[model samples]
Target: MSRSFVKMNGLGNDFVVVEARGAPFRPTPEEVRAIADRESGIGCDQLIAIEPTANADAFMRIWNADGSEVSACGNATRCVGWLLMQAKGDGRATIETLAGLLTTWAAGPRAVTVDMGAPGLGWRDIPMAEDMDTRGVELQVGPIDAPHLHTPGCVSMGNPHVVFFVANAELAPVREVGPMIEHHLLFPEGVNVGFCEVREPDRIRLRVWERGAGETKACGTGACAAVVAASRRGLAKRRATVTLDGGDLKIDWREDDGHVLMSGPVAVEFTGVLP
Candidate 1:
Protein backbone atom coordinates (compact mmCIF):
# COMPACT_ATOMS: atom_id res chain seq x y z
CA MET A 1 0.00 0.00 0.00
CA SER A 2 1.05 3.57 -0.57
CA ARG A 3 1.05 6.30 2.07
CA SER A 4 0.76 10.07 1.79
CA PHE A 5 3.42 12.17 3.47
CA VAL A 6 4.27 15.81 4.07
CA LYS A 7 7.71 17.37 4.07
CA MET A 8 8.24 19.95 6.75
CA ASN A 9 11.09 21.81 8.34
CA GLY A 10 11.83 23.95 11.36
CA LEU A 11 14.97 26.04 10.86
CA GLY A 12 16.15 23.62 8.19
CA ASN A 13 15.93 20.54 10.38
CA ASP A 14 13.62 18.76 7.98
CA PHE A 15 11.18 15.88 8.46
CA VAL A 16 9.01 13.61 6.38
CA VAL A 17 5.72 13.45 8.33
CA VAL A 18 3.24 10.67 7.82
CA GLU A 19 -0.25 10.78 9.28
CA ALA A 20 -1.49 7.43 10.52
CA ARG A 21 -4.18 8.56 12.89
CA GLY A 22 -6.84 6.47 11.16
CA ALA A 23 -4.59 3.56 10.22
CA PRO A 24 -1.57 1.76 11.59
CA PHE A 25 1.79 2.59 10.02
CA ARG A 26 4.77 0.81 11.40
CA PRO A 27 8.11 0.80 9.56
CA THR A 28 11.23 -1.05 10.59
CA PRO A 29 14.56 0.67 11.16
CA GLU A 30 15.83 -0.24 7.71
CA GLU A 31 12.66 1.07 6.09
CA VAL A 32 12.99 4.34 7.92
CA ARG A 33 16.58 4.65 6.68
CA ALA A 34 15.52 4.08 3.09
CA ILE A 35 12.84 6.74 3.30
CA ALA A 36 15.23 9.28 4.81
CA ASP A 37 18.07 8.71 2.39
CA ARG A 38 18.92 11.97 0.63
CA GLU A 39 19.84 10.53 -2.73
CA SER A 40 17.42 7.60 -3.00
CA GLY A 41 14.49 8.57 -0.77
CA ILE A 42 12.47 11.60 0.20
CA GLY A 43 15.33 12.78 2.39
CA CYS A 44 15.04 14.33 5.85
CA ASP A 45 16.86 14.68 9.11
CA GLN A 46 14.09 12.72 10.84
CA LEU A 47 10.89 10.85 10.03
CA ILE A 48 7.73 11.70 11.99
CA ALA A 49 4.56 9.71 12.35
CA ILE A 50 1.42 11.34 13.66
CA GLU A 51 -0.52 8.56 15.32
CA PRO A 52 -3.79 8.31 17.20
CA THR A 53 -3.79 9.15 20.89
CA ALA A 54 -6.39 9.16 23.66
CA ASN A 55 -4.95 11.89 25.89
CA ALA A 56 -3.65 14.43 23.41
CA ASP A 57 -4.30 15.83 19.97
CA ALA A 58 -1.77 13.42 18.48
CA PHE A 59 1.19 11.15 19.20
CA MET A 60 4.49 11.97 17.48
CA ARG A 61 6.95 9.15 16.85
CA ILE A 62 10.40 10.25 15.72
CA TRP A 63 13.12 8.35 13.88
CA ASN A 64 16.53 9.71 13.01
CA ALA A 65 18.16 9.52 9.61
CA ASP A 66 19.98 6.40 10.81
CA GLY A 67 16.54 4.85 11.51
CA SER A 68 16.92 4.94 15.29
CA GLU A 69 13.67 5.68 17.09
CA VAL A 70 14.04 8.46 19.62
CA SER A 71 11.92 9.75 22.48
CA ALA A 72 11.81 13.43 21.54
CA CYS A 73 12.42 15.97 18.76
CA GLY A 74 11.63 19.63 19.32
CA ASN A 75 11.53 20.68 15.66
CA ALA A 76 9.17 17.86 14.68
CA THR A 77 6.85 18.82 17.53
CA ARG A 78 6.46 22.36 16.20
CA CYS A 79 5.82 21.11 12.66
CA VAL A 80 3.16 18.64 13.81
CA GLY A 81 1.67 21.25 16.12
CA TRP A 82 1.23 23.69 13.25
CA LEU A 83 -0.48 21.00 11.16
CA LEU A 84 -2.88 20.13 13.99
CA MET A 85 -3.70 23.73 14.76
CA GLN A 86 -4.25 24.56 11.11
CA ALA A 87 -6.58 21.61 10.69
CA LYS A 88 -8.58 22.45 13.82
CA GLY A 89 -8.42 26.22 13.29
CA ASP A 90 -7.30 26.42 16.89
CA GLY A 91 -4.44 28.29 18.49
CA ARG A 92 -3.13 25.44 20.60
CA ALA A 93 -2.44 21.72 20.39
CA THR A 94 -1.17 19.04 22.70
CA ILE A 95 1.08 16.20 21.60
CA GLU A 96 2.15 13.00 23.31
CA THR A 97 5.57 11.39 22.91
CA LEU A 98 7.68 8.81 24.71
CA ALA A 99 9.31 11.69 26.52
CA GLY A 100 6.04 13.18 27.76
CA LEU A 101 3.12 15.38 26.77
CA LEU A 102 3.92 18.75 25.21
CA THR A 103 1.75 21.80 24.57
CA THR A 104 2.19 24.07 21.56
CA TRP A 105 0.58 27.33 20.54
CA ALA A 106 0.74 29.66 17.61
CA ALA A 107 3.21 32.45 18.20
CA GLY A 108 2.69 34.08 14.82
CA PRO A 109 2.27 33.20 11.17
CA ARG A 110 4.05 29.83 10.83
CA ALA A 111 5.75 30.40 14.15
CA VAL A 112 5.13 28.36 17.31
CA THR A 113 5.99 28.21 20.95
CA VAL A 114 6.37 24.87 22.65
CA ASP A 115 6.35 24.08 26.35
CA MET A 116 9.35 21.73 26.44
CA GLY A 117 8.98 21.04 30.15
CA ALA A 118 11.63 21.22 32.81
CA PRO A 119 15.13 20.04 32.08
CA GLY A 120 16.75 17.15 33.96
CA LEU A 121 19.85 18.40 35.77
CA GLY A 122 20.69 15.70 38.26
CA TRP A 123 23.44 13.18 37.52
CA ARG A 124 20.92 10.35 37.34
CA ASP A 125 18.57 12.46 35.24
CA ILE A 126 21.17 12.85 32.50
CA PRO A 127 21.89 9.13 33.16
CA MET A 128 25.63 9.62 33.09
CA ALA A 129 27.87 6.66 33.81
CA GLU A 130 28.98 8.07 37.18
CA ASP A 131 28.02 10.72 39.70
CA MET A 132 29.33 14.22 39.15
CA ASP A 133 28.26 17.83 38.97
CA THR A 134 26.11 18.22 35.89
CA ARG A 135 27.01 21.89 35.70
CA GLY A 136 30.56 20.99 34.67
CA VAL A 137 31.31 17.32 34.27
CA GLU A 138 34.93 16.20 34.49
CA LEU A 139 35.45 15.31 30.87
CA GLN A 140 38.13 16.63 28.54
CA VAL A 141 39.40 16.22 24.99
CA GLY A 142 42.95 16.75 23.62
CA PRO A 143 45.69 17.53 26.14
CA ILE A 144 45.17 16.82 29.84
CA ASP A 145 46.59 20.11 31.02
CA ALA A 146 44.95 22.24 28.35
CA PRO A 147 42.40 20.24 26.49
CA HIS A 148 40.72 21.54 23.35
CA LEU A 149 37.38 21.16 25.10
CA HIS A 150 36.62 20.49 28.76
CA THR A 151 33.89 20.44 31.38
CA PRO A 152 30.68 20.51 29.39
CA GLY A 153 27.37 21.17 31.09
CA CYS A 154 24.94 18.29 30.79
CA VAL A 155 21.14 18.46 30.68
CA SER A 156 18.28 16.29 29.47
CA MET A 157 15.41 17.97 27.64
CA GLY A 158 13.55 14.69 27.20
CA ASN A 159 16.81 13.56 25.57
CA PRO A 160 20.35 13.58 26.85
CA HIS A 161 22.52 16.60 25.81
CA VAL A 162 25.95 17.98 26.66
CA VAL A 163 26.80 21.61 25.86
CA PHE A 164 30.38 22.75 25.56
CA PHE A 165 30.83 26.48 26.04
CA VAL A 166 33.40 27.77 23.61
CA ALA A 167 35.06 31.09 22.78
CA ASN A 168 34.00 30.76 19.17
CA ALA A 169 31.25 28.45 18.06
CA GLU A 170 32.27 28.60 14.39
CA LEU A 171 35.83 27.55 15.08
CA ALA A 172 34.92 24.54 17.23
CA PRO A 173 35.74 21.18 15.71
CA VAL A 174 32.16 19.96 15.72
CA ARG A 175 32.68 17.08 13.28
CA GLU A 176 35.84 15.81 14.96
CA VAL A 177 34.93 16.25 18.63
CA GLY A 178 31.21 15.72 18.36
CA PRO A 179 31.30 12.03 17.42
CA MET A 180 33.91 11.33 20.07
CA ILE A 181 31.88 12.83 22.91
CA GLU A 182 28.55 11.52 21.65
CA HIS A 183 29.63 7.91 22.17
CA HIS A 184 31.69 8.64 25.23
CA LEU A 185 31.34 6.37 28.26
CA LEU A 186 29.84 9.13 30.37
CA PHE A 187 26.60 9.07 28.40
CA PRO A 188 25.17 5.57 28.67
CA GLU A 189 22.48 6.08 26.04
CA GLY A 190 24.54 8.44 23.91
CA VAL A 191 24.14 12.25 23.88
CA ASN A 192 23.61 15.24 21.59
CA VAL A 193 26.62 17.50 21.60
CA GLY A 194 26.38 21.31 21.40
CA PHE A 195 29.04 23.90 20.79
CA CYS A 196 27.82 27.19 22.22
CA GLU A 197 29.37 30.64 22.13
CA VAL A 198 27.76 33.19 24.37
CA ARG A 199 27.54 36.44 22.44
CA GLU A 200 25.69 38.32 25.13
CA PRO A 201 23.66 37.73 28.25
CA ASP A 202 20.53 37.23 26.20
CA ARG A 203 22.02 35.99 22.93
CA ILE A 204 24.28 33.17 21.79
CA ARG A 205 25.35 31.05 18.85
CA LEU A 206 25.08 27.27 18.79
CA ARG A 207 25.70 24.18 16.68
CA VAL A 208 24.63 20.64 17.54
CA TRP A 209 25.75 17.17 16.58
CA GLU A 210 22.66 15.11 17.17
CA ARG A 211 22.97 11.49 18.12
CA GLY A 212 22.01 9.11 15.31
CA ALA A 213 21.79 12.15 13.03
CA GLY A 214 24.79 14.20 12.13
CA GLU A 215 24.91 18.00 12.21
CA THR A 216 21.82 19.74 10.94
CA LYS A 217 20.76 23.32 10.35
CA ALA A 218 18.99 23.54 13.65
CA CYS A 219 17.87 21.58 16.70
CA GLY A 220 15.08 23.01 18.88
CA THR A 221 15.75 20.80 21.88
CA GLY A 222 19.45 21.53 21.56
CA ALA A 223 18.73 25.25 21.63
CA CYS A 224 16.70 24.92 24.82
CA ALA A 225 19.38 22.71 26.35
CA ALA A 226 22.03 25.24 25.38
CA VAL A 227 20.26 28.08 27.15
CA VAL A 228 19.70 25.94 30.21
CA ALA A 229 23.32 24.81 30.25
CA ALA A 230 24.53 28.36 29.72
CA SER A 231 22.38 29.64 32.55
CA ARG A 232 23.67 26.96 34.88
CA ARG A 233 27.23 28.03 34.18
CA GLY A 234 26.40 31.76 34.52
CA LEU A 235 27.30 32.21 30.89
CA ALA A 236 23.90 33.44 29.77
CA LYS A 237 20.54 34.48 31.15
CA ARG A 238 17.49 32.28 31.65
CA ARG A 239 16.02 33.65 28.48
CA ALA A 240 18.10 34.05 25.33
CA THR A 241 18.19 33.93 21.56
CA VAL A 242 20.13 31.01 20.09
CA THR A 243 21.42 31.50 16.56
CA LEU A 244 22.00 28.24 14.72
CA ASP A 245 23.20 27.61 11.21
CA GLY A 246 19.67 27.65 9.85
CA GLY A 247 18.17 30.50 11.86
CA ASP A 248 17.33 31.77 15.34
CA LEU A 249 15.25 30.48 18.25
CA LYS A 250 14.06 32.24 21.36
CA ILE A 251 14.37 30.07 24.43
CA ASP A 252 13.02 31.05 27.79
CA TRP A 253 13.72 29.05 30.90
CA ARG A 254 11.00 30.45 33.09
CA GLU A 255 12.31 31.17 36.55
CA ASP A 256 8.95 30.64 38.26
CA ASP A 257 7.86 27.43 36.55
CA GLY A 258 11.29 26.16 35.47
CA HIS A 259 9.80 24.95 32.22
CA VAL A 260 11.73 25.74 29.07
CA LEU A 261 9.83 27.42 26.26
CA MET A 262 11.08 27.25 22.69
CA SER A 263 9.80 29.64 20.04
CA GLY A 264 10.54 29.23 16.33
CA PRO A 265 9.07 29.00 12.84
CA VAL A 266 7.93 25.93 10.87
CA ALA A 267 7.67 25.47 7.13
CA VAL A 268 6.12 22.90 4.80
CA GLU A 269 8.46 21.96 2.02
CA PHE A 270 6.01 19.83 0.01
CA THR A 271 3.84 16.70 0.01
CA GLY A 272 4.21 13.35 -1.68
CA VAL A 273 3.09 9.72 -1.79
CA LEU A 274 5.19 6.86 -0.46
CA PRO A 275 5.23 3.66 -2.47
Candidate 2:
Protein backbone atom coordinates (compact mmCIF):
# COMPACT_ATOMS: atom_id res chain seq x y z
CA MET A 1 0.00 0.00 0.00
CA SER A 2 1.15 3.52 -0.79
CA ARG A 3 1.37 6.10 2.00
CA SER A 4 1.38 9.86 1.74
CA PHE A 5 4.29 11.83 3.16
CA VAL A 6 5.15 15.47 3.62
CA LYS A 7 8.59 16.93 3.13
CA MET A 8 9.32 19.67 5.60
CA ASN A 9 12.30 21.50 6.94
CA GLY A 10 13.37 23.80 9.78
CA LEU A 11 16.30 25.94 8.76
CA GLY A 12 17.25 23.40 6.10
CA ASN A 13 17.16 20.43 8.47
CA ASP A 14 14.65 18.44 6.49
CA PHE A 15 12.31 15.57 7.34
CA VAL A 16 9.93 13.13 5.68
CA VAL A 17 6.77 13.37 7.77
CA VAL A 18 4.23 10.58 7.52
CA GLU A 19 0.86 10.84 9.22
CA ALA A 20 0.22 7.47 10.86
CA ARG A 21 -2.60 8.42 13.16
CA GLY A 22 -5.09 6.08 11.55
CA ALA A 23 -2.56 3.30 10.94
CA PRO A 24 0.82 2.34 12.26
CA PHE A 25 3.75 3.19 10.02
CA ARG A 26 6.62 1.05 11.26
CA PRO A 27 9.47 0.80 8.81
CA THR A 28 12.47 -1.44 9.24
CA PRO A 29 15.95 -0.04 9.52
CA GLU A 30 16.73 -1.05 5.98
CA GLU A 31 13.58 0.55 4.64
CA VAL A 32 14.31 3.75 6.56
CA ARG A 33 17.78 3.88 5.04
CA ALA A 34 16.34 3.41 1.55
CA ILE A 35 13.81 6.21 1.97
CA ALA A 36 16.48 8.52 3.35
CA ASP A 37 18.87 7.84 0.50
CA ARG A 38 19.47 11.07 -1.33
CA GLU A 39 20.36 9.44 -4.63
CA SER A 40 17.47 7.05 -5.05
CA GLY A 41 14.74 7.90 -2.53
CA ILE A 42 12.99 10.87 -0.92
CA GLY A 43 15.92 12.17 1.06
CA CYS A 44 15.59 13.69 4.51
CA ASP A 45 17.65 14.11 7.63
CA GLN A 46 15.05 12.26 9.62
CA LEU A 47 11.81 10.35 9.10
CA ILE A 48 8.90 11.30 11.35
CA ALA A 49 5.77 9.30 12.06
CA ILE A 50 2.93 11.21 13.70
CA GLU A 51 1.05 8.52 15.56
CA PRO A 52 -2.17 8.92 17.55
CA THR A 53 -1.87 9.65 21.24
CA ALA A 54 -4.21 9.90 24.19
CA ASN A 55 -2.36 12.46 26.32
CA ALA A 56 -1.07 14.88 23.74
CA ASP A 57 -2.27 15.88 20.29
CA ALA A 58 0.05 13.25 18.81
CA PHE A 59 3.07 11.05 19.43
CA MET A 60 6.11 11.70 17.30
CA ARG A 61 8.48 8.85 16.48
CA ILE A 62 11.81 9.83 14.97
CA TRP A 63 14.46 7.95 13.01
CA ASN A 64 17.69 9.42 11.76
CA ALA A 65 18.86 9.02 8.18
CA ASP A 66 21.11 6.18 9.35
CA GLY A 67 18.00 4.33 10.47
CA SER A 68 18.63 4.82 14.18
CA GLU A 69 15.45 5.33 16.15
CA VAL A 70 16.02 8.29 18.47
CA SER A 71 14.16 9.94 21.27
CA ALA A 72 13.97 13.65 20.38
CA CYS A 73 14.43 16.16 17.60
CA GLY A 74 13.63 19.84 18.22
CA ASN A 75 13.48 20.98 14.61
CA ALA A 76 11.19 18.13 13.67
CA THR A 77 9.06 18.99 16.70
CA ARG A 78 8.43 22.51 15.41
CA CYS A 79 7.52 21.17 11.99
CA VAL A 80 5.09 18.65 13.47
CA GLY A 81 3.57 21.29 15.74
CA TRP A 82 2.91 23.53 12.80
CA LEU A 83 1.21 20.70 10.96
CA LEU A 84 -1.08 19.97 13.91
CA MET A 85 -1.90 23.61 14.47
CA GLN A 86 -2.64 24.09 10.80
CA ALA A 87 -4.89 21.06 10.86
CA LYS A 88 -6.79 22.20 13.95
CA GLY A 89 -6.83 25.88 12.97
CA ASP A 90 -5.32 26.71 16.34
CA GLY A 91 -2.23 28.42 17.67
CA ARG A 92 -1.06 25.75 20.09
CA ALA A 93 -0.39 22.03 19.98
CA THR A 94 1.12 19.36 22.19
CA ILE A 95 3.39 16.56 21.03
CA GLU A 96 4.56 13.52 22.96
CA THR A 97 7.87 11.74 22.42
CA LEU A 98 10.22 9.43 24.25
CA ALA A 99 11.86 12.54 25.65
CA GLY A 100 8.62 13.89 27.09
CA LEU A 101 5.67 16.06 26.23
CA LEU A 102 6.45 19.26 24.32
CA THR A 103 4.16 22.27 24.05
CA THR A 104 4.30 24.37 20.93
CA TRP A 105 2.61 27.59 19.78
CA ALA A 106 2.55 29.59 16.62
CA ALA A 107 5.08 32.37 16.93
CA GLY A 108 4.45 34.02 13.56
CA PRO A 109 3.82 33.11 9.97
CA ARG A 110 5.89 29.97 9.20
CA ALA A 111 7.42 30.13 12.67
CA VAL A 112 6.78 28.09 15.80
CA THR A 113 7.99 28.03 19.41
CA VAL A 114 8.63 24.78 21.23
CA ASP A 115 9.09 24.29 24.94
CA MET A 116 11.80 21.60 25.00
CA GLY A 117 11.51 20.94 28.69
CA ALA A 118 14.25 21.18 31.29
CA PRO A 119 17.71 19.99 30.39
CA GLY A 120 19.36 17.13 32.25
CA LEU A 121 22.51 18.35 33.98
CA GLY A 122 23.54 15.45 36.16
CA TRP A 123 26.15 12.99 34.95
CA ARG A 124 23.60 10.24 35.23
CA ASP A 125 21.19 12.21 33.12
CA ILE A 126 23.63 12.40 30.26
CA PRO A 127 24.48 8.86 31.30
CA MET A 128 28.17 9.24 30.89
CA ALA A 129 30.47 6.31 31.44
CA GLU A 130 31.73 7.77 34.68
CA ASP A 131 31.13 10.60 37.11
CA MET A 132 32.27 13.97 35.81
CA ASP A 133 31.23 17.60 35.85
CA THR A 134 28.71 18.08 33.10
CA ARG A 135 29.73 21.73 32.98
CA GLY A 136 33.13 20.64 31.60
CA VAL A 137 34.02 17.06 30.99
CA GLU A 138 37.73 16.28 31.00
CA LEU A 139 38.32 15.19 27.42
CA GLN A 140 41.01 16.41 25.06
CA VAL A 141 41.56 15.97 21.33
CA GLY A 142 45.20 16.96 20.84
CA PRO A 143 48.53 16.46 22.56
CA ILE A 144 48.60 15.66 26.28
CA ASP A 145 50.10 19.03 27.24
CA ALA A 146 48.34 21.25 24.69
CA PRO A 147 45.05 19.87 23.49
CA HIS A 148 43.13 21.34 20.60
CA LEU A 149 39.64 20.88 22.05
CA HIS A 150 39.15 20.11 25.70
CA THR A 151 36.57 20.32 28.46
CA PRO A 152 33.25 20.28 26.63
CA GLY A 153 29.98 20.94 28.43
CA CYS A 154 27.56 18.05 28.37
CA VAL A 155 23.79 18.30 28.48
CA SER A 156 20.85 16.07 27.72
CA MET A 157 18.01 17.86 25.95
CA GLY A 158 16.16 14.59 25.46
CA ASN A 159 19.31 13.33 23.74
CA PRO A 160 22.90 13.50 24.87
CA HIS A 161 24.93 16.45 23.55
CA VAL A 162 28.39 17.92 24.05
CA VAL A 163 29.20 21.52 23.20
CA PHE A 164 32.78 22.59 22.63
CA PHE A 165 33.52 26.28 22.93
CA VAL A 166 35.58 27.38 19.98
CA ALA A 167 37.12 30.58 18.70
CA ASN A 168 35.49 30.15 15.31
CA ALA A 169 32.66 27.81 14.52
CA GLU A 170 33.63 27.62 10.88
CA LEU A 171 37.18 26.60 11.71
CA ALA A 172 36.18 23.90 14.14
CA PRO A 173 37.19 20.39 13.07
CA VAL A 174 33.68 19.08 12.92
CA ARG A 175 34.12 16.33 10.37
CA GLU A 176 37.47 15.27 11.74
CA VAL A 177 36.66 15.16 15.45
CA GLY A 178 32.89 14.82 15.59
CA PRO A 179 32.75 11.13 14.80
CA MET A 180 35.49 10.33 17.30
CA ILE A 181 33.80 12.11 20.20
CA GLU A 182 30.32 10.99 19.25
CA HIS A 183 31.23 7.34 19.73
CA HIS A 184 33.67 7.97 22.56
CA LEU A 185 33.53 5.82 25.65
CA LEU A 186 32.54 8.80 27.78
CA PHE A 187 29.22 8.97 26.00
CA PRO A 188 28.14 5.34 25.98
CA GLU A 189 24.91 6.13 24.17
CA GLY A 190 26.62 8.21 21.49
CA VAL A 191 26.22 11.99 21.44
CA ASN A 192 25.62 14.99 19.24
CA VAL A 193 28.69 17.19 18.88
CA GLY A 194 28.32 20.97 18.75
CA PHE A 195 30.96 23.54 17.99
CA CYS A 196 29.81 26.87 19.39
CA GLU A 197 31.38 30.29 18.99
CA VAL A 198 30.05 33.03 21.21
CA ARG A 199 29.85 36.31 19.36
CA GLU A 200 28.06 38.25 22.11
CA PRO A 201 26.44 37.64 25.42
CA ASP A 202 23.14 37.22 23.60
CA ARG A 203 24.38 35.87 20.30
CA ILE A 204 26.41 32.92 19.08
CA ARG A 205 27.40 30.88 16.02
CA LEU A 206 27.07 27.11 15.99
CA ARG A 207 27.75 24.01 13.93
CA VAL A 208 26.60 20.53 14.79
CA TRP A 209 27.44 16.96 13.78
CA GLU A 210 24.45 14.92 14.71
CA ARG A 211 24.93 11.39 16.08
CA GLY A 212 23.33 9.46 13.24
CA ALA A 213 22.71 12.17 10.64
CA GLY A 214 26.24 13.56 10.37
CA GLU A 215 26.33 17.35 9.85
CA THR A 216 23.05 19.12 9.31
CA LYS A 217 22.37 22.74 8.49
CA ALA A 218 20.67 23.34 11.82
CA CYS A 219 19.69 21.44 14.95
CA GLY A 220 17.00 22.88 17.23
CA THR A 221 17.94 20.91 20.33
CA GLY A 222 21.59 21.52 19.59
CA ALA A 223 20.94 25.25 19.55
CA CYS A 224 19.18 25.01 22.90
CA ALA A 225 21.97 22.89 24.35
CA ALA A 226 24.57 25.35 23.09
CA VAL A 227 22.90 28.20 24.96
CA VAL A 228 22.71 26.20 28.14
CA ALA A 229 26.33 25.14 27.83
CA ALA A 230 27.43 28.72 27.15
CA SER A 231 25.42 30.02 30.07
CA ARG A 232 26.92 27.45 32.38
CA ARG A 233 30.40 28.34 31.14
CA GLY A 234 29.76 32.10 31.66
CA LEU A 235 30.42 32.72 27.99
CA ALA A 236 26.84 33.71 27.09
CA LYS A 237 23.58 34.67 28.73
CA ARG A 238 20.61 32.46 29.43
CA ARG A 239 18.88 33.54 26.24
CA ALA A 240 20.63 34.02 22.93
CA THR A 241 20.18 34.06 19.17
CA VAL A 242 22.00 31.01 17.77
CA THR A 243 23.14 31.49 14.21
CA LEU A 244 23.36 28.17 12.39
CA ASP A 245 24.61 27.37 8.92
CA GLY A 246 21.15 27.56 7.41
CA GLY A 247 19.62 30.31 9.59
CA ASP A 248 19.07 31.71 13.07
CA LEU A 249 17.19 30.33 16.05
CA LYS A 250 16.04 32.05 19.24
CA ILE A 251 16.87 29.93 22.27
CA ASP A 252 15.83 30.90 25.76
CA TRP A 253 16.73 28.85 28.80
CA ARG A 254 14.17 30.38 31.09
CA GLU A 255 15.33 31.05 34.65
CA ASP A 256 11.91 30.78 36.21
CA ASP A 257 10.56 27.72 34.49
CA GLY A 258 13.89 26.00 33.81
CA HIS A 259 12.58 24.95 30.42
CA VAL A 260 14.31 25.66 27.15
CA LEU A 261 12.23 27.39 24.48
CA MET A 262 13.31 27.11 20.85
CA SER A 263 11.79 29.33 18.18
CA GLY A 264 12.41 28.94 14.46
CA PRO A 265 10.78 28.87 11.05
CA VAL A 266 9.27 25.79 9.37
CA ALA A 267 8.88 25.17 5.64
CA VAL A 268 7.06 22.62 3.54
CA GLU A 269 9.17 21.62 0.58
CA PHE A 270 6.77 19.21 -1.17
CA THR A 271 4.42 16.28 -0.66
CA GLY A 272 4.15 12.90 -2.31
CA VAL A 273 3.14 9.28 -1.89
CA LEU A 274 5.70 6.71 -0.78
CA PRO A 275 5.78 3.46 -2.68
Pick the lDDT winner.
Answer: 2
Q: Could you give candidate 2's per-residue lDDT for residues 9-45 as a string of tens digits?
A: 9999999999999889999999999999999999999
The lDDT values for all models are 0.95, 0.97
How high is each candidate's TM-score? 0.99, 0.99
TM-score of model 2 vs. true structure: 0.99
Alpha carbon deviation, residue 36, candidate 1 (Å)? 0.9
Clashes of 1: 0
lDDT of 1 by residue, 66-174 (tens): 9899999999999999999999999999999999999999999999999999999999998799999999999988989889999999999999999999999999999
Q: Candidate 2: worst 10 consecutive residues by lDDT? A: 121-130
The CA root-mean-square deviation of candidate 1, after full C-alpha superposition on the true structure, stands at 0.6
Residue 68, candidate 2: how far off, in angstroms? 0.7
